[model samples]
Target chain A: MPDRSVAGPLTDPGPSHPCGGTSPRTGEPDGRPATAPGCNGRVTAPPDDCLARNEWICGAYLSSRRDILWGAVLQHLQLTAVSVLIGLVIAVPLALAARRWRWAAGPVLGVTTILYTVPSLAMFSLLLPVYGLSASLVVAGLVLYSLTLLVRNILAGLRAVPEETRQAARGMGYGPVRLLVAVELPLALPAAMAGLRIATVSAVSLVTIGAIVGYGGLGNLIYSGMNTYFKAQVLTASVLCVVIAVAADLLLLLAQRLLTPWTRRQS
Target chain B: MNILSEAWSWLTTSAHWYGQDGIWTRLAQHLVLTVVCLLISCLIALPVALVLGHLGKGGALAVNISNIGRAVPTFAVLVLLLLTPIGRFGEGPTVVALVLFAVPPLLTNAYVGMREVDQDVVRAARGMGMTGRQMLFQVEVPLALPLIMTGVRIAAVQLVATATIAALAGGGGLGRIITAGFNLASTAQVVAGAVLVAAFALIVEGLFELAQRLAPGRVRGGNTG
Candidate 1:
C-alpha cells in the first residue's frame, strides 16, 4: 500500500544501446573504443549499464537476505526458548505425578490429547476471550500444545527404565525423591530431551502462526508477502523457515548426542 | 418460554440449520477436507516410510525430517504459501499446506511400525523362500499394520484440527464460522464451531479405532506393546 511509484523507475530498463560503444569499466555512458575480446572470444566485463543493473539486483538480494535471516532466527529462537521452558516446567511435574499415580495419567493424557487435537488458531481464538490478542495468548496456546509431547515422552522414558535398576536403587536405601532425581531422571533425560526437541521445533513453527494475531515473527514476513502477492518476500521467508527448521533440528540432535553419550555408543 | 424449552428450541433450530446449508454443510466440507488430506498424506508417506524402515540406515534422518515437518505450524505454512505464485491460485495453496502438515505423522508411523516388526519373523519369512516383496506384504506389513493404523489415527486427528487453518486463507470450512465468530465477538458461535470440530474429530477417531480393533490378529497383536 505504501507508494509503489518509486519502484517504477527501478524496473524500467531504459533504452537499449549497442554493447560496444561505451567503456564497460567506467559505467559513465561515455563514448569510447569498445574493449577487445579476450582469448575466450568474449569481453570479461559486462556492459557498464548491465553491471549497474546486476549490482542493483545483488544489493536487493543481500538486503532481503539479511532482513529475513536475522528477523526469522531471532523471532524463532525467542518464541521456542520461552515456550519450551514454560512447557518443561509444567510437563515434568505432571509427568512425574502421572508415573507415580497411574490413575492421574488417564485424565492428564486425555486433557493434553484433546488440547493437542485442537487447531492452533482455534486454540488461540479460545484463549482470545480471556487473554485478548496479546503475546500471552500465543505463549499460553503454544505451551499447552507442547505439553502432550513432553509429558508423554517423559512418562515413556521413566517407564522404559529397567525394573532391575529401580530395585537396585531402592536396595541402596534411596528414597523415592532421591531415586527419581539421582537414578531415574538421568536415564530419562535422553527421552525428555527428545521430547523437548520436538516441542521446541513445534514451538518455532507455530510461532509463525502467531503473526496472524499480530504477534510478529518470521510468519509475519510470510503473511505479508502472501497477502500482497510478493514472490521475493514469500520465497525468502519460506526458504528461511526451512533453513531455520533444519538448523534447529541439527543443533538439537547434536545437543541430544552430547547429553546422552550412551545413545551414541549404543547406536 | 422457560430456559429448558428455549434451549431445546435453539437446539432444534440449530439442527434444522445443520440440515440446510448451515453448520452441517460446513462441518461436512471440513470433515471431507480433513479426511482427504490425511488419507492422501498417509498413502504417500507409507510406502516411502516402509522403504526407509527396511533400509534402517537413515531412520534417524528420516525421523528428524518428519519431526521438523511436524513442528512447522500449519497456519504458518498456509500463510507462507499464500505469497507464492501458487498462492495466486488460492485454495490449492491451502490444500498443499495441509498436506505438508499431515505428512510427518504418517511417515513416522509407517517407518516405526515396520522397523518394530520382529526381526525373527522377517528372517523366518525369508528362510521360507518368500521374496522380499512377498515378505514385506505377507509378513512385515501384516505385523506392522496396527502401528501404522495408530499413526493414521494420529494423523487423522491432527489433520482435522489443522484444517481449520484453511479458513484463514479464505477457504471454506468450519473454521470460517469460528473466525467469523471471533471477528464478531460471538463466543457462542465460536463455541458452536469448536464443538462441531471436536465432535467430528472424535467420530473419525472412533471409526479408526474400530477398524484397528477389527484388523487381523497378525496386524494387531505384537504392536500393542
Candidate 2:
C-alpha cells in the first residue's frame, strides 16, 4: 500500500488491450478520480494521463475474458488425465507379464527406458510423420514416457508382497488369479498409486511442450505471451500449470492414504 | 524406415554441417549450455544436499520442495525469465531456467544416497574417532557414489532434452535446428535434429552407467531414485 500516486503512473490499464474493443473493466468513461484532491485519501482512480499509459496486464486475463484461460486449463487437464490413464492401462499388464516370465522384464524395462530418455520435444517431432501434428501425437509420446515409471513401480509393488505371505495364501488353496486379485494387487496398489502420481505430474509439465506442435494446454498461452511480450498471460499460464500439477499430486496423495489403511497403520 | 533414411540424408548433407547455423555448431552450443548449466546446478544442489544428509535433518522437506519445484514447466520458467530485466543478458535466462529444471533430481538423489549409507559403518567411523567432515567425505561419499552418479545421469539426460527450450528464448542450442526446421516446414530436418538430441542423451546415459558399474560392487546395487 505504499504511495498509490507513485505506483499509479507505472500501470495505466490503458485501452490497448489485445482483445481490443473495451471490455467491462476498460469501458468505464472518466475512470480517473477527480474527487481526490492532490493525491490525498480515498483515491479511487488515477489522473487522466496515467490511463493512457501501457498496461502490464493485458486483456488476456481480464475478468470478462477468463473463459479463454478456463478452456486452456481444461485442455491441460484432459491431456494429462488421458495420457496418464493410457500409461497406467498399458503398464499394469506389462508389469504383470514381467513378474510372471522373468525374461520379459529385461526387454520391457529396456524399451521403456529408452523411450523415457527421449526428450519430450524430440519424441513429439519424431512422431510428426505418423501423427501429423494431432493432439494424439502428444498423448502417444506422453504415454510412452509414463510407461517406465508406472511399470517399475507396479513391478516393485508386486514384488514387495512377501514370499511368506504368498506361501500362506497358497497353503489356503488360493488359486493364482484369486491370490493376485485378493492379495497381491491390493498390496501393490500403494506403489502403483505413487507411480500414478509421478506420472500425472510429469504429464502436466510435458503437455506444455505440446504447444510447439500447436496442442499444448496452458502452453499456448505461454507461447503467445512470450511472442507478444505479454507478462500476464505467461505468468497466468505458468501459475496454472503449477497449480494443476500440485493439486493432482496432493489429491493422489490423499487417495493413497485413504486406499491403503494398512500402510498408514504400519507407518 | 523411410523417416530414418530421410533423417540420415538430411544429416549427411555437407551444407547442413557447416557455418554459424550448421548442425555441428548447434551441437557444440547445445553441449556447452548443458555442461555449464549442469555444473551450476551441481554447485547449487550438491553441497546443500550433502550437508543436510550428514546432519540427518530436513532431507524430506528439501526433497519435497524440489518435487513441487519440478512441476513448474521449464518452458514456462524460460518464458517468464525472458520477460524480466534479467532477459537482457541473452543466455543468462536460458541457463537459469535450465539450472532450475535440473536441480531437483541432483538434490534428491544426493540426499537419499547419503542418508542410505550403512549406520553400522557410520558408528564404526565414529568409534574410530574420525571427524564428521572426514566421515562424510571418506565414508558416506564413497558409499553414495552410485546414487549420486545416478542423479547426475538423470539430470544430464534431462538437461539434454530440456535444453531445446533455449532456442525459443533466443539462446543457442540444437533446439535451434528443430525450430529452424519447423519454420522451414522440413520434416526431415526436424527428425534429424531430434535424432541428434536423442543420440546425445543415450550416449550421456551410457557413460554414466559405465561409471556406475566401475564403482565398488556393494554400492553399484544402490537404489537410484
Candidate 3:
C-alpha cells in the first residue's frame, strides 16, 4: 500500500524547482514539493530536458493547454461515466425487486439514506482501509453515492405507472419480466432520467474531492492552486469546473429532450 | 479488546479538540458560521421573494434565476470564489459561497408560497381597504407560512451538509475533524465527524418538523379547511 504518511497536504507547490524559492504571486513554492510538475502549476517540462526546465511553458499553448484541458475533461468524464453506469446496473434491479416484493423498499431505502448522509470526504476516508489509494476505491465510493439518487428516481418512476396500465398488461397474459421490459420500463424512463440527472450533477461535484486521495481530476487543479496559493490556476480550475458543470447540465437537458420526447411536447 | 481500548483512548483525545477550552475553544465558532450563513441568505432572499410575490411582476425571471442557482454546485462555487478578491480573505469567501448556495431554495419557496395564497383571501383583504403591505403581512404571509417553513427546512439541511466543505476553505467546523481524520488515516475520527454531521442534520430536520407541527392552525390547515 502507498504510504499514507507521505501523502502531502492538499495544498502544495506545483512543478517549479525547489531552488526557485517562493513564487511571486503564490507564497508557496513554485510547484508543490511533493507533487510532480504539471500536477499543480501551468509549468510544463520540456521533452529533452524535463528535469532542467523551470519556466512555466515548455511548449506552445495548443500542446500544453490541450493536454491539460483534455486531461481534466477525460478524468471528469471517466469518473462520472463509471459511477453512473455502475449505479444504474445496481439500482435498476434493486428498484425492480423493491417493486416486486414491496418489503425490499424499506431496507433498500434505509441503506441508501444512510450512505447519502455520509459526507463524501468521510466516505472516501472510510474506504481507504479496505481499498487503499486506488481508482477502484474512488469509483466504488462514487457508485455507492450515486445509488441513492438513482434508486429513488427509478422507484418513483415505477410507482407512478397507472394501476390500469398494469392490469391491462396482466390481462394480456404478460409475465412480470415481460411487463417490466415493455411497459413499466418505458413509463419509468422519465423519472429514472430525472434521477440520473441528479446523480450526474452530484457525481460531477463530488469527483473533485477524489483529488484528496491523489485520484487526479479537475479538482486537482483547485486543490493544487490552494496548496501553492496560485490564485490564477485556482481561478482557472474553478471557472473551468463551473463551465464544465453548466455544459454537463445542458447536455443532460438535451439528452432528456431527446430521450423523452413526450416530456418535450408537454412543455 | 485492543480495538475497544484504542477507540476509548481516541475518544478521550477527541474531547481535547471539542468543547470550550479545547482545540478551537467552544462550538460557537461552528455555530456562528452556520447561523450567519443561514441568516444572511434568508435576509436577502426573503425580501426579494416578498416583493416579487406581492408585485407579481418579474416572477418568471426571479424563478429562472433560482433554477440556475440550483444547478450551481456549492462546492464548485466555494472553490471558484477562492480565486476572487473576496476569497483571499479566507472565511469571507466561504460565507459568500454558502449564501449563494442557500438563496435559491429560500427565494423560490418563499415566492411560490406567497403566490399560492388563496386568491379570495387576498382580494378580501384588499377590499377591506388593507394596504398591499398590510395584505402581505396580515393575509399572504400567514397563509404562506407552512410552505415558507418547508423551504427553510430544506435550506437548513443543505446548509448543514455544505458547511462541511467550509473546512476545506479554512472555515472551521466539524469538517476540520473529518479532513484531519482523512489526512491521518484515522477511520474513527472520520466516522465521529460524519456521525456528528448526520446527527446534526437529523436534529435540524426534527426541529423543523416541530416547527411545522406548531405552525398557526390557519396556515397549517388553511388549504384543507
Candidate 4:
C-alpha cells in the first residue's frame, strides 16, 4: 500500500519469479515483500532455489530457516532441561521416601510405572485438559514419565550403599542427615547418573511427540514439514533431535565418570 | 462443561462406536497395527539377539546399535519414512518406524538375557549331549524366558502406545479419534480417545505382567523398560 511504483533492487523478484509470489494476496505481500515492479506486484516462488526444487538436503532451506530451526532447537532444549530438572527435583524426595519407608516404595514405584506405561500421545492428551495444550502439558507428562526411571535408580543407588558403609559413617560421629548428605548421596551418584542419562535421552526423543500440540519445538517443524512433505525440514529437525539426544547422553556419561571417578575402569 | 462427564457421554454414545470410523473400528486398527508391528519386530530382533547372545559375540555392537536406535525419535522416523518413497506403500512407513522402535528393546533384552544365562547351565546341557540348537532352545531360552518375556512385554506395550502415530499418517487407529477431536475442537472426544489408548496400554502391560508371573523361570529379568 505504501509505494508499489518504485521497484528497487531489494524488491527484485529476479528473472525466476515472473509474478511475485504464488500467494494471491496482491499488493499486501505475504512475508518480506520481495516483490518487484516489473512483475505487476504478483510475488511468486523463487526461480532457482532448492526450496522450489523441493530437494531433501537443501542448504538454502537451512539458511532461510535458520531462525526457525534454531528457535525450535532452543525450545526443544528448554523443554528437555526444564522437565528433567523438575523431574529430578520431584524424584529425589520420592526416592528418599521410598527408601526410608518400606511401605512407600510399592506405591511410588507402582504409580510411576503405570504413568510410564501411558503412551506419550495419551499422556499429553490426558494432560491437555489440565495444562490446556501448553508447553507445560508436555513438561508435566515428561516429568511423570521420568519418575519411573529416576525413582527406581535413585532408590537402587541408595540401597546399594552398604550397611557397613552406613555403620562406618555413623561410627564416625555422623548423624543421619550428615551421613545421607555426605556419604550416601555421593555413593549413589553412579546409578543415579545412569538413570539421568537415560531419562534425558528419552526425554529428548519424547519431546518430538509434543508436536501433537503447538509447542513441540523441532517437533512442530517436523509436524508441519511432514504435513507439507517438506523434506529438508523434516530430515534436518529429526537429525538435530538425534544429535541432541546423543550429545546429552554423552555429556551425562562424562559427568557421571567425573563425579564418580572411583567407578572408572582400572586402566 | 465438566470434562469427565463430557468424555463419559462421548464414550457412552452408541453412534460413536458403530461405524467404519467408530471407536470399535479404531480400536481394532490400533490393536492390529500393534500386533503386526510386534510380530514383525520379534521376528527380526529375537533371532539376531539369540544368535548373538548365544555366540557371546557382537553383543556389545548389537547393544550399542540398539542404543543409537533408541536415541532416534519414533515420531521423526515415522514422518521421515512417511515422507520417503516407502510412504507410497500404505502403512509401510508406520510399520517400519514402529518395527524399528520395537526392535531395540526386544534385541537389547534378548541379547542381554541370553548372555546373562548361567554358563554352568550351558555346560551341563552340552554335557547332556545337547546340540547348539537344543542347548539354545531348551536350556538357554528357558533360562532367559523371564527377561525375554520382559522384552516382549515392553515392546508390546510400546507398540500399543506408538501405533497411535498411524492415525497421524492417515492410517486408522485410536489416535484418529483424538486428532479428529482436535480438528472438531471437541475436548470430550479427545479425552475419550486418550483414555481409551491409555487404558489399552495398561491392559496390555498388565496382561504381560500376568503372563510373566505365571510363566516359569521367575528370574526377575529386565526390571525396567
What TM-score does each of the candidates earn? 0.77, 0.87, 0.81, 0.90
**What is every candidate's C-alpha DockQ against the true complex, given to 2 decimals?**
0.25, 0.45, 0.28, 0.44
CA lDDT, candidate 4, residue A185:
96
Better of 2 and 4 by DockQ: 2
What is candidate 4's DockQ?
0.44
Tens digit of per-residue lDDT, candidate 2, span B1-225: 798899899999999999988988988988999999899999998998899999999877767866776688888998888778787787878888889878888999999999989988999999999999999998888888777888888899878887876665566788877777776778888899888878887888888888878766756864533
CAPRI-style class, candidate 3:
acceptable
Would candidate 1 be rated incorrect, acceptable, medium or high by CAPRI criteria? acceptable
Give the Cα lDDT of each candidate: 0.69, 0.80, 0.70, 0.81
Cα lDDT tens digits, model 1, B25-84, are 777778778878877887788888887887675688657666677656676567556544
Q: Candidates 3 and 4: which is better by TM-score?
A: 4
lDDT by residue (tens digit), candidate 4, A192-242: 998998899989999988877777768877777766566777888999999
Q: For candidate 3, lDDT tens digit of each residue in B1-225?
A: 343344346656856566643445324555677788899989998888888998887678667665576455565566566655686575777788878877888888888888888799889999999998899898888888777777777777677767776666555666676666666776666555555555665677778778777776765644535
Off by over 4 Å in 1: A1-75, A254-267, B1-21, B50-62, B88-90, B185-188, B214-216, B222-225
Provide the clash count, candidate 1: 1
lDDT, candidate 3, A139-240, per-residue tens = 888899899999999999999999999999999999988999988998999899878877877777787777767664667766665555455555555556
Runs in model 2 deviating more than 4 A are A1-60, B216-225
Off by over 4 Å in 4: A1-46, A265-267, B217-225
